[model samples]
Target chain A: MDREEIRVAVLRIEGTNCEEETATSFRNLGVEAEIVHLKQFYSDMIRFEDQRSIFDYHCIVFPGGFSAGDYVRAGAIFSARVKSVLRKDLEEFIKYNYPILGICNGFQILAELGALPGFDEDRPISDRPEMALAINDSGRFECRQTLLRVESRKCVFTKEIEKDKLQIPVAHAEGKVVFPRGREEEYLEKLKENEQLVFRYVDDKGNYSGYPWNPNGSFYNIAGICNVTHTVLGLMPHPERVTFDYRKNSFGDGYYIFKSVISYLEKI
Target chain B: MITFLFCEKLIVFMIADVHIELKEGVADPEGESTLKALRLLGYKRVKKVSSVRVFRIEIDTKSKEEAEKEIKEICERLLANPVIHRYRINWIG
Candidate 1:
């Protein structure tokens, strides 16, 4: 499909504040991107014209923000609502190998929905979440620029970025990625072996550091990851926030992420 | 009519209190901060502190066992994240 033919859906609901920037990122790339409400896809209360089908879009972007107020764990409420209503559509979306990107709170939602570390191939969505994005070790909301080392090129979202490290802004109180206790080592090994590990938080010197350098103190300093299919990706950083051109020196390292998605869709 | 409504309320409403906390190994920053504050206030004997989320859930069930079962499912599926936290359910009749 042509780049223009790529219909990207930047999904949002109440409290999801990043949809506009996410959609604009795709629009800047000359693709048709729309900020779609979760209600539009599932709620019957919406008008016929407003209601939409998930299958209508080629790519779905779950943008950042505290959806449904991030109560009862950051993304649990939103994830449960999605599962209750649109689980089949999401499963089918994953089955067909379309790209799904989740940033920050979106990352938490994907994990809550069992879409990350998607261990079971026959079942893309796990019956229960195997991992979680827990509260920051700092005990407060952290908002700052973070250095991320690109650990893998296997994902459809990060394939175009040739750089070893990129500076992206991370804003969240619950961005610490943790697997279930006792299974951490085994799961980490499996993720490494599968090449599903996407990005790791690092310091300016490119070393895996602790505390503020690692921000929320994510497990293994992991900043992002993908599923076995390499299509569904969940990361804590806000790539959309940096896609603008004003930062000439860094040249918006995140722009390549959207470009990679566009390139991947074009080939399909 | 008032007695009937009161009796009906007694049979219909059941409240379960759930307390959820991060597992022993998982880091608890809020708990740690509370400990720090206590230390600063000269509470030297207080060795540690932990934080927990208390959820009071009202479920419609006739028997206590059914209420417990339903609340347990609710905690497992929504209130608690099994990956990082463990939860206990208490029947508050």
Candidate 2:
């Protein structure tokens, strides 16, 4: 579709701090982007003009934040709220191949909602989340810039990114993506076979490393993943934080994520 | 200053205790940190350290069977993430 027709909803709830940056990045790309409160889609008290439907947008994003204070778990409250209130409509949204991008806490929410590692095509959102973004191995909030190797050829968000690796900032206490207790090996193999794995943490030399390099100690150094169809993607890094070059005002590493999906939408 | 209903049961308040912790094989960073601190404080004999979070919830149902089923569903849906954490529910009279 045309860039003018590409409307993006940078979705947020209270404590979601990145909606402005995410929406600004999209607007910079010449597309229509709005910072939409999650309530606007559900609250009956919202004025008619202020109300929104997920179907009203070409794409929707869950931006990074300590949503709902990250209580109980990083994204549990937010994800449960979404699943309880907007489950049916969200499933329908996925059916249309509209890209859903989740960054940082957003990634945590998607994992909680069973939207990542979504194995079955027939069920875009699983009844139970197949993965979890646990706390960092450091036992403290890790805020640092990490290198990521683009690991998926099928991911719509990164397809236009010609570079094999990108430097993105990650700031969160919980981002260590883990599979079920004993099924780590099995799930890793399935992710590889299905090509749903998106990004892997790497070192300066671009090799998978440990400790500060891997950041949260995510299994297989996995930094991001997507659903089977690649329409949905969830990653720990904040791509919105670095979408433009300050000096040249040119596109940065994260800008291509937005660019690629818009191009994909244009084609489909 | 309030009146009690005559039909109210004398002992009907039900509580379900949910104990959640990381799966056995999963790394417990917080517990590990605590263990390290204990060792530094001269407690060298401490073999290991582990931790769990307990949530006490009041279920509306009076029947034990119904309360058990509802608590299980609650644990599965919201109280705990099955991927990294496992939970055990205990009933309190």
By summed lDDT, the worst window of 10 consecutive residues in model 1 chain A runs over A242-251
A194-234, model 2: which lDDT tens digit per residue? 99889999999999999899999999999999998888999
lDDT of 1 by residue, A64-145 (tens): 9999999898989988988889888998999999999999999999999999988776788987899999989999999999
DockQ of 2: 0.78
Residue B38 of candidate 2: its Cα lDDT?
99
Q: What is the DockQ of each candidate?
A: 0.80, 0.78
Off by over 4 Å in 2: B1-11
TM-score, per-candidate, Cα-based = 0.95, 0.94
Question: Which pairs clash in the backbone of model 1?
Answer: none
CA lDDT of every candidate? 0.90, 0.89
User: In model 1, how many backbone clashes occur?
Assistant: 0
